[model samples]
Target chain A: MRDGKDDAAPRARRRFLKLAGLGTAASGAALLAGSGAAKAAAPAATEAAKGYRVTDHVRRVYDLARF
Target chain B: MIAPEDQGRAYLYRLLARLLAAAPDAATLGLLRGLGGDGSPVGGDLQGLAGAAATAGPGALEREYHDLFIGVGRGELVPFGSWYLAGFLHEKPLAHLRRDLGTLGLGRTAGTKEPEDHVASLCEAMALLIEGKGDLGAQKAFFERHLEGWAPAFFADLERARAARFYAAVGRLGARLMTLERDGFAFVEGVAA
Candidate 1:
Protein backbone atom coordinates (compact mmCIF):
# COMPACT_ATOMS: atom_id res chain seq x y z
CA MET A 1 0.00 0.00 0.00
CA ARG A 2 2.87 2.35 -0.67
CA ASP A 3 1.64 5.64 -2.09
CA GLY A 4 2.78 9.15 -2.96
CA LYS A 5 2.50 9.89 0.74
CA ASP A 6 5.31 7.42 1.33
CA ASP A 7 7.51 9.22 -1.15
CA ALA A 8 6.55 12.57 0.31
CA ALA A 9 7.21 11.74 3.96
CA PRO A 10 10.97 12.26 3.92
CA ARG A 11 10.66 15.40 1.84
CA ALA A 12 8.06 16.75 4.19
CA ARG A 13 10.26 15.94 7.17
CA ARG A 14 13.16 17.78 5.54
CA ARG A 15 10.98 20.80 4.92
CA PHE A 16 9.83 20.78 8.53
CA LEU A 17 13.47 20.61 9.63
CA LYS A 18 14.41 23.48 7.32
CA LEU A 19 11.61 25.60 8.69
CA ALA A 20 12.84 24.82 12.20
CA GLY A 21 16.24 26.40 11.24
CA LEU A 22 18.05 23.12 10.98
CA GLY A 23 19.95 21.99 7.84
CA THR A 24 21.22 25.52 7.23
CA ALA A 25 24.71 25.82 5.83
CA ALA A 26 26.14 28.13 8.46
CA SER A 27 24.55 26.51 11.50
CA GLY A 28 25.31 23.01 10.32
CA ALA A 29 28.92 23.89 9.52
CA ALA A 30 29.35 25.63 12.85
CA LEU A 31 27.89 22.71 14.73
CA LEU A 32 29.59 19.94 12.76
CA ALA A 33 33.01 21.52 12.28
CA GLY A 34 33.46 24.50 14.58
CA SER A 35 32.20 22.59 17.60
CA GLY A 36 34.98 20.10 17.35
CA ALA A 37 34.78 19.60 21.10
CA ALA A 38 32.56 16.53 20.96
CA LYS A 39 33.82 13.72 18.84
CA ALA A 40 31.45 11.83 16.61
CA ALA A 41 30.02 8.71 18.31
CA ALA A 42 31.20 6.03 15.98
CA PRO A 43 30.11 2.41 16.37
CA ALA A 44 33.14 0.92 14.63
CA ALA A 45 35.67 0.76 17.42
CA THR A 46 33.07 0.00 20.06
CA GLU A 47 31.81 -2.88 17.97
CA ALA A 48 35.28 -4.25 17.56
CA ALA A 49 36.65 -3.64 21.04
CA LYS A 50 35.23 -6.45 23.16
CA GLY A 51 32.22 -8.70 23.21
CA TYR A 52 31.18 -5.96 25.61
CA ARG A 53 31.74 -2.59 23.97
CA VAL A 54 31.93 0.89 25.40
CA THR A 55 31.79 3.59 22.79
CA ASP A 56 34.94 5.71 22.62
CA HIS A 57 32.84 8.82 22.29
CA VAL A 58 30.94 7.97 25.43
CA ARG A 59 34.10 7.07 27.26
CA ARG A 60 35.78 10.31 26.25
CA VAL A 61 32.73 12.28 27.29
CA TYR A 62 32.97 10.63 30.71
CA ASP A 63 36.67 11.32 30.91
CA LEU A 64 36.14 14.97 30.15
CA ALA A 65 33.26 15.26 32.57
CA ARG A 66 35.35 13.79 35.36
CA PHE A 67 36.38 16.30 37.97
CA MET B 1 22.99 7.87 2.45
CA ILE B 2 22.87 10.01 5.53
CA ALA B 3 21.18 13.32 4.76
CA PRO B 4 22.58 16.71 5.68
CA GLU B 5 19.63 17.35 7.98
CA ASP B 6 20.40 14.09 9.73
CA GLN B 7 24.03 15.10 10.13
CA GLY B 8 22.88 18.31 11.74
CA ARG B 9 20.64 16.31 14.01
CA ALA B 10 23.47 13.99 14.97
CA TYR B 11 25.75 16.90 15.79
CA LEU B 12 23.11 18.56 17.89
CA TYR B 13 22.71 15.33 19.84
CA ARG B 14 26.48 15.09 20.17
CA LEU B 15 26.65 18.64 21.46
CA LEU B 16 23.99 17.94 24.00
CA ALA B 17 25.68 14.76 25.08
CA ARG B 18 28.94 16.61 25.59
CA LEU B 19 27.43 19.38 27.63
CA LEU B 20 25.37 17.03 29.71
CA ALA B 21 28.35 14.77 30.16
CA ALA B 22 30.42 17.60 31.63
CA ALA B 23 30.89 21.32 31.62
CA PRO B 24 32.65 22.55 28.50
CA ASP B 25 36.29 23.56 28.56
CA ALA B 26 37.39 27.05 27.46
CA ALA B 27 37.91 25.87 23.90
CA THR B 28 34.42 24.42 23.75
CA LEU B 29 33.02 27.56 25.30
CA GLY B 30 34.74 29.68 22.68
CA LEU B 31 33.23 27.62 19.94
CA LEU B 32 29.81 27.89 21.57
CA ARG B 33 30.15 31.66 21.87
CA GLY B 34 30.59 31.91 18.13
CA LEU B 35 27.40 30.02 17.31
CA GLY B 36 24.51 31.88 15.61
CA GLY B 37 20.88 31.05 15.16
CA ASP B 38 17.79 32.21 13.28
CA GLY B 39 14.14 32.89 14.20
CA SER B 40 12.99 29.33 14.79
CA PRO B 41 12.43 28.05 18.31
CA VAL B 42 15.47 25.78 18.13
CA GLY B 43 17.43 28.74 16.80
CA GLY B 44 16.29 30.89 19.69
CA ASP B 45 17.44 28.23 22.15
CA LEU B 46 20.78 28.08 20.33
CA GLN B 47 21.09 31.84 20.75
CA GLY B 48 20.32 31.45 24.43
CA LEU B 49 23.03 28.80 24.71
CA ALA B 50 25.46 31.07 22.89
CA GLY B 51 24.72 33.90 25.27
CA ALA B 52 25.20 31.66 28.29
CA ALA B 53 28.45 30.35 26.87
CA ALA B 54 29.73 33.85 26.28
CA THR B 55 29.18 34.80 29.90
CA ALA B 56 30.16 31.59 31.67
CA GLY B 57 33.58 30.52 32.95
CA PRO B 58 34.72 26.93 33.30
CA GLY B 59 35.15 26.95 37.05
CA ALA B 60 31.68 28.39 37.65
CA LEU B 61 30.11 26.07 35.12
CA GLU B 62 31.81 23.10 36.72
CA ARG B 63 30.46 24.07 40.08
CA GLU B 64 27.01 24.64 38.67
CA TYR B 65 27.11 21.29 36.91
CA HIS B 66 28.06 19.56 40.11
CA ASP B 67 25.28 21.18 42.04
CA LEU B 68 22.77 20.31 39.39
CA PHE B 69 23.81 16.72 38.61
CA ILE B 70 26.35 15.46 41.14
CA GLY B 71 25.83 16.83 44.59
CA VAL B 72 27.29 15.26 47.77
CA GLY B 73 24.37 12.88 48.18
CA ARG B 74 22.32 13.43 45.04
CA GLY B 75 21.97 16.41 42.79
CA GLU B 76 18.90 18.51 42.31
CA LEU B 77 18.06 16.21 39.44
CA VAL B 78 19.05 12.64 38.65
CA PRO B 79 19.73 12.39 34.91
CA PHE B 80 19.18 8.71 34.56
CA GLY B 81 16.28 7.16 32.63
CA SER B 82 15.68 4.45 35.19
CA TRP B 83 15.54 7.00 37.96
CA TYR B 84 12.98 9.03 36.08
CA LEU B 85 10.99 6.14 34.77
CA ALA B 86 11.03 3.84 37.76
CA GLY B 87 11.68 6.19 40.65
CA PHE B 88 15.06 4.57 41.30
CA LEU B 89 18.34 3.86 39.64
CA HIS B 90 19.39 0.45 38.21
CA GLU B 91 15.85 -0.70 37.70
CA LYS B 92 14.12 -2.78 35.07
CA PRO B 93 14.22 -0.05 32.47
CA LEU B 94 17.99 -0.12 32.58
CA ALA B 95 17.97 -3.85 32.22
CA HIS B 96 15.74 -3.53 29.17
CA LEU B 97 17.98 -0.88 27.69
CA ARG B 98 21.02 -3.04 28.27
CA ARG B 99 19.37 -5.84 26.35
CA ASP B 100 18.57 -3.50 23.49
CA LEU B 101 22.09 -2.11 23.49
CA GLY B 102 23.47 -5.59 23.36
CA THR B 103 21.32 -6.32 20.34
CA LEU B 104 22.74 -3.18 18.73
CA GLY B 105 26.30 -4.20 19.60
CA LEU B 106 26.78 -1.46 22.19
CA GLY B 107 27.70 -1.64 25.89
CA ARG B 108 28.83 0.44 28.76
CA THR B 109 32.51 1.25 28.64
CA ALA B 110 34.43 -0.52 31.38
CA GLY B 111 35.37 1.63 34.39
CA THR B 112 32.35 3.87 33.97
CA LYS B 113 30.25 4.03 37.10
CA GLU B 114 27.27 5.76 35.58
CA PRO B 115 24.52 3.52 34.37
CA GLU B 116 23.89 3.19 30.66
CA ASP B 117 20.66 5.09 31.08
CA HIS B 118 22.30 8.35 32.00
CA VAL B 119 21.01 11.19 29.89
CA ALA B 120 24.36 11.91 28.26
CA SER B 121 24.92 8.29 27.36
CA LEU B 122 21.46 8.04 25.87
CA CYS B 123 22.03 11.18 23.84
CA GLU B 124 25.31 9.76 22.59
CA ALA B 125 23.54 6.55 21.67
CA MET B 126 21.00 8.52 19.68
CA ALA B 127 23.80 10.40 17.94
CA LEU B 128 25.44 7.17 16.96
CA LEU B 129 22.16 5.83 15.63
CA ILE B 130 21.66 8.93 13.54
CA GLU B 131 25.21 8.73 12.23
CA GLY B 132 24.47 5.34 10.59
CA LYS B 133 24.82 2.76 13.31
CA GLY B 134 21.07 2.34 13.14
CA ASP B 135 18.33 3.11 10.65
CA LEU B 136 15.28 5.32 11.04
CA GLY B 137 13.12 2.52 12.39
CA ALA B 138 15.71 1.65 14.97
CA GLN B 139 16.17 5.26 15.97
CA LYS B 140 12.47 5.80 16.40
CA ALA B 141 12.10 2.68 18.47
CA PHE B 142 15.02 3.43 20.75
CA PHE B 143 13.93 7.01 21.30
CA GLU B 144 10.34 6.13 22.07
CA ARG B 145 11.33 3.38 24.39
CA HIS B 146 14.09 5.08 26.33
CA LEU B 147 13.60 8.84 26.02
CA GLU B 148 10.01 9.57 25.13
CA GLY B 149 8.69 8.28 28.42
CA TRP B 150 10.41 10.91 30.57
CA ALA B 151 13.18 12.99 28.97
CA PRO B 152 10.96 16.01 28.30
CA ALA B 153 9.94 16.16 31.91
CA PHE B 154 13.58 15.84 32.95
CA PHE B 155 14.55 18.72 30.72
CA ALA B 156 11.75 20.86 32.08
CA ASP B 157 12.93 20.05 35.59
CA LEU B 158 16.49 20.88 34.63
CA GLU B 159 15.37 24.24 33.30
CA ARG B 160 13.80 25.02 36.63
CA ALA B 161 16.43 23.44 38.83
CA ARG B 162 17.81 25.78 41.50
CA ALA B 163 21.41 25.32 40.42
CA ALA B 164 20.65 25.95 36.79
CA ARG B 165 22.24 28.98 35.13
CA PHE B 166 24.03 28.00 31.95
CA TYR B 167 22.26 24.65 32.12
CA ALA B 168 18.91 26.41 32.10
CA ALA B 169 19.61 27.28 28.51
CA VAL B 170 20.61 23.69 27.95
CA GLY B 171 17.33 22.55 29.43
CA ARG B 172 15.37 24.77 27.10
CA LEU B 173 17.30 23.54 24.09
CA GLY B 174 16.93 19.92 25.20
CA ALA B 175 13.20 20.26 25.72
CA ARG B 176 12.82 21.85 22.32
CA LEU B 177 14.89 19.15 20.61
CA MET B 178 12.92 16.41 22.31
CA THR B 179 9.70 17.87 20.99
CA LEU B 180 11.12 18.15 17.50
CA GLU B 181 12.42 14.59 17.62
CA ARG B 182 9.07 13.25 18.74
CA ASP B 183 7.35 15.05 15.91
CA GLY B 184 9.95 13.95 13.40
CA PHE B 185 9.56 10.30 14.37
CA ALA B 186 5.81 10.59 14.16
CA PHE B 187 6.20 11.94 10.62
CA VAL B 188 8.14 8.82 9.72
CA GLU B 189 5.53 6.50 11.23
CA GLY B 190 2.71 8.33 9.50
CA VAL B 191 4.40 7.81 6.17
CA ALA B 192 5.29 4.22 6.87
CA ALA B 193 1.76 3.40 7.90
Candidate 2:
Protein backbone atom coordinates (compact mmCIF):
# COMPACT_ATOMS: atom_id res chain seq x y z
CA MET A 1 0.00 0.00 0.00
CA ARG A 2 2.91 2.35 0.65
CA ASP A 3 4.42 1.98 -2.85
CA GLY A 4 1.00 1.83 -4.55
CA LYS A 5 0.64 5.65 -4.56
CA ASP A 6 0.43 8.27 -7.32
CA ASP A 7 4.20 7.98 -8.11
CA ALA A 8 3.98 4.16 -8.44
CA ALA A 9 1.41 4.46 -11.25
CA PRO A 10 3.62 6.75 -13.36
CA ARG A 11 6.74 4.62 -12.74
CA ALA A 12 4.99 1.40 -13.82
CA ARG A 13 3.77 3.13 -17.02
CA ARG A 14 7.32 4.30 -17.78
CA ARG A 15 8.73 0.80 -17.22
CA PHE A 16 6.14 -0.71 -19.56
CA LEU A 17 7.02 1.82 -22.29
CA LYS A 18 10.75 1.13 -21.85
CA LEU A 19 10.18 -2.65 -22.01
CA ALA A 20 8.08 -2.24 -25.15
CA GLY A 21 10.87 -0.23 -26.84
CA LEU A 22 13.46 -2.89 -25.91
CA GLY A 23 11.23 -5.68 -27.22
CA THR A 24 10.84 -3.87 -30.57
CA ALA A 25 14.60 -3.33 -30.83
CA ALA A 26 15.27 -7.01 -30.05
CA SER A 27 12.72 -8.16 -32.63
CA GLY A 28 14.18 -5.82 -35.28
CA ALA A 29 17.69 -7.15 -34.65
CA ALA A 30 16.46 -10.76 -34.94
CA LEU A 31 14.57 -9.94 -38.12
CA LEU A 32 17.65 -8.32 -39.65
CA ALA A 33 19.76 -11.37 -38.83
CA GLY A 34 17.13 -13.67 -40.26
CA SER A 35 16.93 -11.57 -43.45
CA GLY A 36 20.71 -11.74 -43.83
CA ALA A 37 20.65 -15.51 -43.45
CA ALA A 38 17.91 -15.75 -46.09
CA LYS A 39 19.85 -13.53 -48.46
CA ALA A 40 22.93 -15.69 -48.02
CA ALA A 41 20.82 -18.81 -48.62
CA ALA A 42 19.65 -17.57 -52.04
CA PRO A 43 23.04 -17.67 -53.80
CA ALA A 44 23.70 -21.17 -52.50
CA ALA A 45 20.40 -22.33 -53.96
CA THR A 46 21.26 -20.87 -57.37
CA GLU A 47 24.50 -22.86 -57.46
CA ALA A 48 22.81 -26.25 -56.98
CA ALA A 49 20.95 -26.37 -60.33
CA LYS A 50 23.77 -24.59 -62.10
CA GLY A 51 23.04 -24.54 -65.86
CA TYR A 52 20.20 -27.05 -65.66
CA ARG A 53 17.35 -26.11 -67.97
CA VAL A 54 13.73 -27.05 -67.40
CA THR A 55 12.58 -30.33 -68.96
CA ASP A 56 9.54 -29.56 -71.13
CA HIS A 57 8.92 -33.10 -72.32
CA VAL A 58 5.93 -34.89 -70.91
CA ARG A 59 6.73 -37.39 -68.20
CA ARG A 60 7.89 -40.73 -69.59
CA VAL A 61 7.68 -43.91 -67.53
CA TYR A 62 10.41 -45.86 -69.29
CA ASP A 63 13.91 -45.46 -67.97
CA LEU A 64 15.87 -44.97 -71.19
CA ALA A 65 18.95 -45.89 -69.24
CA ARG A 66 17.28 -49.13 -68.23
CA PHE A 67 17.60 -50.29 -71.82
CA MET B 1 19.47 -56.06 -81.76
CA ILE B 2 16.21 -54.12 -81.75
CA ALA B 3 13.07 -55.97 -80.69
CA PRO B 4 9.46 -55.75 -81.85
CA GLU B 5 8.29 -56.27 -78.30
CA ASP B 6 10.09 -53.04 -77.50
CA GLN B 7 7.17 -51.06 -78.84
CA GLY B 8 5.98 -47.51 -78.05
CA ARG B 9 9.44 -46.09 -77.65
CA ALA B 10 8.21 -42.82 -79.06
CA TYR B 11 8.71 -41.57 -75.51
CA LEU B 12 12.43 -41.79 -76.06
CA TYR B 13 12.11 -39.87 -79.30
CA ARG B 14 9.88 -37.33 -77.64
CA LEU B 15 12.46 -36.92 -74.87
CA LEU B 16 15.16 -36.36 -77.47
CA ALA B 17 13.11 -33.78 -79.36
CA ARG B 18 12.41 -31.96 -76.12
CA LEU B 19 16.02 -32.10 -74.93
CA LEU B 20 17.16 -30.77 -78.29
CA ALA B 21 14.45 -28.16 -78.70
CA ALA B 22 14.55 -26.89 -75.13
CA ALA B 23 17.32 -28.42 -73.01
CA PRO B 24 18.12 -31.44 -70.90
CA ASP B 25 16.07 -32.47 -67.90
CA ALA B 26 16.67 -30.28 -64.89
CA ALA B 27 16.68 -33.53 -62.97
CA THR B 28 19.85 -34.56 -64.77
CA LEU B 29 21.54 -31.29 -63.73
CA GLY B 30 23.68 -31.16 -66.89
CA LEU B 31 25.66 -34.23 -66.06
CA LEU B 32 26.73 -36.30 -69.10
CA ARG B 33 25.73 -39.63 -67.63
CA GLY B 34 26.22 -42.50 -70.12
CA LEU B 35 23.18 -43.11 -72.41
CA GLY B 36 23.74 -45.86 -75.00
CA GLY B 37 22.20 -48.29 -72.59
CA ASP B 38 22.10 -51.55 -74.48
CA GLY B 39 22.18 -54.67 -72.34
CA SER B 40 25.74 -55.07 -73.55
CA PRO B 41 28.16 -52.74 -75.26
CA VAL B 42 29.83 -54.00 -78.41
CA GLY B 43 32.22 -51.05 -78.87
CA GLY B 44 31.01 -48.42 -76.42
CA ASP B 45 34.35 -47.04 -75.26
CA LEU B 46 35.67 -46.22 -78.70
CA GLN B 47 32.31 -44.94 -79.80
CA GLY B 48 32.06 -42.74 -76.71
CA LEU B 49 35.52 -41.36 -77.45
CA ALA B 50 34.75 -40.60 -81.08
CA GLY B 51 31.44 -38.93 -80.34
CA ALA B 52 32.53 -37.02 -77.21
CA ALA B 53 33.28 -34.08 -79.49
CA ALA B 54 29.62 -33.49 -80.38
CA THR B 55 28.35 -32.66 -76.89
CA ALA B 56 25.64 -30.05 -77.32
CA GLY B 57 26.71 -27.45 -74.78
CA PRO B 58 27.24 -24.23 -76.74
CA GLY B 59 28.43 -24.11 -80.35
CA ALA B 60 30.36 -27.38 -80.43
CA LEU B 61 27.46 -29.60 -81.49
CA GLU B 62 26.23 -27.22 -84.20
CA ARG B 63 29.76 -26.96 -85.58
CA GLU B 64 30.06 -30.72 -85.50
CA TYR B 65 26.77 -30.99 -87.40
CA HIS B 66 28.06 -28.48 -89.92
CA ASP B 67 31.30 -30.36 -90.33
CA LEU B 68 29.47 -33.65 -90.56
CA PHE B 69 26.79 -32.44 -92.96
CA ILE B 70 27.01 -28.73 -93.86
CA GLY B 71 30.66 -27.88 -93.40
CA VAL B 72 32.69 -26.47 -96.29
CA GLY B 73 34.94 -29.48 -95.84
CA ARG B 74 33.60 -33.02 -95.77
CA GLY B 75 32.10 -34.24 -92.52
CA GLU B 76 33.37 -37.19 -90.53
CA LEU B 77 30.14 -39.15 -89.94
CA VAL B 78 27.75 -39.28 -92.92
CA PRO B 79 24.57 -39.73 -90.74
CA PHE B 80 23.11 -41.98 -93.39
CA GLY B 81 23.14 -45.77 -93.91
CA SER B 82 22.88 -45.42 -97.67
CA TRP B 83 26.03 -43.30 -97.77
CA TYR B 84 27.89 -45.93 -95.80
CA LEU B 85 26.20 -48.94 -97.47
CA ALA B 86 26.15 -47.99 -101.12
CA GLY B 87 29.15 -45.56 -101.11
CA PHE B 88 26.79 -42.73 -102.09
CA LEU B 89 24.29 -40.49 -100.35
CA HIS B 90 21.12 -41.65 -102.09
CA GLU B 91 20.70 -45.32 -102.95
CA LYS B 92 18.29 -48.26 -103.03
CA PRO B 93 17.51 -47.91 -99.35
CA LEU B 94 16.05 -44.50 -99.99
CA ALA B 95 14.19 -45.60 -103.10
CA HIS B 96 12.82 -48.51 -101.16
CA LEU B 97 11.80 -46.13 -98.43
CA ARG B 98 9.76 -44.18 -100.96
CA ARG B 99 8.20 -47.32 -102.41
CA ASP B 100 7.36 -48.52 -98.94
CA LEU B 101 6.07 -45.04 -98.24
CA GLY B 102 3.66 -45.41 -101.17
CA THR B 103 2.51 -48.76 -99.87
CA LEU B 104 2.03 -47.31 -96.41
CA GLY B 105 0.44 -44.21 -97.89
CA LEU B 106 3.03 -42.07 -96.11
CA GLY B 107 4.37 -39.13 -98.13
CA ARG B 108 7.51 -37.08 -97.85
CA THR B 109 7.19 -33.47 -96.96
CA ALA B 110 7.34 -30.90 -99.80
CA GLY B 111 11.09 -30.57 -100.39
CA THR B 112 12.72 -32.47 -97.59
CA LYS B 113 15.11 -34.77 -99.44
CA GLU B 114 18.09 -35.45 -97.24
CA PRO B 115 17.41 -39.13 -97.95
CA GLU B 116 15.73 -41.66 -95.66
CA ASP B 117 18.96 -42.48 -93.90
CA HIS B 118 19.23 -39.09 -92.29
CA VAL B 119 19.19 -39.37 -88.50
CA ALA B 120 16.05 -37.28 -88.23
CA SER B 121 14.42 -39.38 -90.90
CA LEU B 122 15.52 -42.49 -89.08
CA CYS B 123 14.04 -41.06 -85.93
CA GLU B 124 10.85 -40.26 -87.76
CA ALA B 125 10.81 -43.79 -89.14
CA MET B 126 11.31 -45.24 -85.70
CA ALA B 127 8.50 -43.10 -84.38
CA LEU B 128 6.27 -44.33 -87.16
CA LEU B 129 7.28 -47.86 -86.34
CA ILE B 130 6.48 -47.42 -82.68
CA GLU B 131 3.07 -46.03 -83.55
CA GLY B 132 2.36 -48.70 -86.23
CA LYS B 133 1.77 -45.91 -88.72
CA GLY B 134 3.12 -47.74 -91.75
CA ASP B 135 2.84 -51.35 -92.91
CA LEU B 136 4.43 -52.69 -89.76
CA GLY B 137 5.84 -55.85 -91.29
CA ALA B 138 7.50 -54.22 -94.32
CA GLN B 139 8.70 -51.30 -92.24
CA LYS B 140 10.08 -53.75 -89.74
CA ALA B 141 11.91 -55.57 -92.49
CA PHE B 142 13.27 -52.34 -93.93
CA PHE B 143 14.44 -51.23 -90.49
CA GLU B 144 16.15 -54.54 -89.82
CA ARG B 145 18.02 -54.59 -93.12
CA HIS B 146 18.72 -50.93 -93.74
CA LEU B 147 19.01 -49.29 -90.34
CA GLU B 148 20.14 -52.04 -87.99
CA GLY B 149 23.64 -52.36 -89.36
CA TRP B 150 24.78 -48.81 -90.11
CA ALA B 151 22.66 -46.65 -87.85
CA PRO B 152 24.49 -48.03 -84.81
CA ALA B 153 27.77 -47.07 -86.44
CA PHE B 154 26.53 -43.56 -87.06
CA PHE B 155 25.23 -43.22 -83.50
CA ALA B 156 28.48 -44.58 -82.10
CA ASP B 157 30.39 -41.95 -84.02
CA LEU B 158 27.94 -39.33 -82.87
CA GLU B 159 28.28 -40.35 -79.21
CA ARG B 160 32.02 -39.87 -79.28
CA ALA B 161 32.12 -36.89 -81.61
CA ARG B 162 34.31 -34.06 -80.37
CA ALA B 163 31.26 -31.85 -79.90
CA ALA B 164 29.16 -34.54 -78.26
CA ARG B 165 28.12 -33.67 -74.72
CA PHE B 166 24.44 -33.03 -75.03
CA TYR B 167 24.50 -34.83 -78.36
CA ALA B 168 26.36 -37.68 -76.70
CA ALA B 169 23.29 -38.21 -74.60
CA VAL B 170 21.23 -38.04 -77.78
CA GLY B 171 23.54 -40.56 -79.42
CA ARG B 172 23.24 -42.78 -76.42
CA LEU B 173 19.47 -42.61 -76.61
CA GLY B 174 19.60 -43.37 -80.32
CA ALA B 175 22.01 -46.23 -79.89
CA ARG B 176 19.94 -47.69 -77.09
CA LEU B 177 16.82 -47.39 -79.20
CA MET B 178 18.58 -49.13 -82.06
CA THR B 179 19.59 -51.96 -79.78
CA LEU B 180 16.01 -52.30 -78.61
CA GLU B 181 14.74 -52.37 -82.16
CA ARG B 182 17.42 -54.75 -83.34
CA ASP B 183 16.75 -57.19 -80.53
CA GLY B 184 13.02 -56.91 -80.99
CA PHE B 185 13.40 -57.77 -84.67
CA ALA B 186 15.74 -60.59 -83.85
CA PHE B 187 13.23 -62.04 -81.41
CA VAL B 188 10.58 -62.02 -84.10
CA GLU B 189 12.97 -63.71 -86.46
CA GLY B 190 13.80 -66.29 -83.81
CA VAL B 191 10.21 -67.16 -82.78
CA ALA B 192 8.83 -64.41 -80.56
CA ALA B 193 10.76 -65.65 -77.55
Candidate models: Cα lDDT each = 0.73, 0.43
Clashing pairs in 1: none
- Model 2, B1-193: lDDT tens digits are 2221222244343333233323333233232233232222322422342244233443454554455443343445555566667766557877766776556555554443234445554554454554445433554576776677687877777778775555665677567656655654442322211
DockQ of 2: 0.01
Q: Superposing all C-alpha atoms, what RMSD in Å does each candidate have to the true structure?
A: 5.8, 26.2
Q: What is the lDDT of residue B186 in candidate 1?
A: 68
By DockQ thresholds, what CAPRI class is model 1?
A: incorrect
Model 1 misplaced stretches (Cα beyond 4 Å) = A1-6, A25-67, B190-193
Best by lDDT: 1
lDDT per residue (tens digit) for residues B141-186 in model 1: 8899899999999999999999999999999988987888888876
TM-score of each: 0.83, 0.52
Best candidate, DockQ-wise?
1
